[model samples]
Target chain A: MEWIRFFITAALLIMGMISFISAVIGVYRFGFVMNRMHAAGIGDTLGLLCVVSAMAVASGLNMDTLKLLFLIFFMWFTSPVSTHFLSQVEYYTNRERARFMTFRKGGEPRES
Target chain B: MNIDQAYHLLFMGALIIFAVLIGIMLIRAVIGPRITDRILSINMIGTMTICSIAILSGLLHEGYLTDVALIYAMLSFVAVLILAVMYIPAKSTRGQKQSRPEMADTAKEKKLQQSQSGETTRQKARKKGKKA
Candidate 1:
């Protein structure tokens, strides 16, 4: 029925918004750059999936649904790469990272 | 309520929530301690914007907005990539003989061997600790 479809779509959309809300709170509350990134990753992935799936459900079978799917797929592929690059930049740029992290000359983790 | 009315209410609520989240993210971008944090916030805001746009596509019955969302995704990825590239130091930027990690480790070892006459005791201890 139309009511069933609408309820399903509404539920999915609300669920996605909840995840986004939590992710934003995490981004705000976390102390360090890596911590904030971990929070943001949730929004990039799970939140996006939920929201897009809601859209797909509401739109039904169409070229637009296909486009939404592609958008989700592309985001999944690129999000990790961006996260990796961000970590690399953090590693190379932060001279004071050793204060928070340990890097040994060999195999061991040097205590800071 | 009719299906259209329910759907309209859903989208209106979603858009409002997304707007609030985007505003919070803008605050995060402004207060973020580092460049990476700012980039990360921007990346998240882009994603939320894409969500709203997709929702709007359904609400407005405009199929083209979905295409716009796809394009936005690609552009956001490129923005993050370009910004990340800017932060990564070039090979020649340090003016060091070491090209990579292995070479840099060896160079550190070599420097460990050649202690100068004016080297302080703390510096010597630091070098010895590094060699271990």
Candidate 2:
């Protein structure tokens, strides 16, 4: 049973790591800054979710596990909100909107 | 290796990977073009740090790690909020136009020259009328 749990945890951790590294690469390689921000959302929320869930399982159903779940829940709730606000700030401060392909086709400017 | 030992090794590997992810984010935060990009990178690092603390809490059999994770979450929230508020006033102030005196002087000189030329043309026409 312990071996099975370990295997599960290892697999989930590897998956999370791979997603995170890819997100970093995506942030670097993506043309538009907004796109990079989108990539970051994946790594921050879902990637963490997978790894934390696995760790909670490995730790068993105890108080520690509950704490892990709580952390995951907090992340899910906060990460997107923060990302949204940050993106809004970035949009307002910079004139890089032209660089985004999505803005090229008659897109309206956001109200400040 | 025993199953328990394998679990420990797996945890160690995961911890190492998390560390590497944090390092990568730090690099991004350093080189990112804009302030918001840096904030995003820092936020990601914070999330991963919380995960690292959780894992360590398990490994060390320390209950305090959970408390630390909770605190980190709160800190991150506050930091991001502060950043958002800072952006607002700074952005609004940027939109206000404050032209330099030198630029205004040059513009004023060009307008004066145009008006003088127009007056000279009118004066010549009046002299022609007087001659007639």
Number of the top candidate by DockQ? 1
Between which residue pairs do clashes occur in model 2?
Answer: none
Off by over 4 Å in 2: A101-112, B89-132
Candidate 1 structure, TM-score to reference: 0.82
Error of 2 at B88 (Å): 2.3
lDDT of 1 by residue, B57-118 (tens): 99999999999999999999999999998877654435555644321133333244333224
lDDT of 2 by residue, A1-112 (tens): 7777777888887788788888888888876667888898888887888878877877788888888888888888888888878876765566444334233111123322
**Residue A66 of candidate 1: its Cα lDDT?**
93
What does the lDDT read for residue A62 in candidate 1?
90
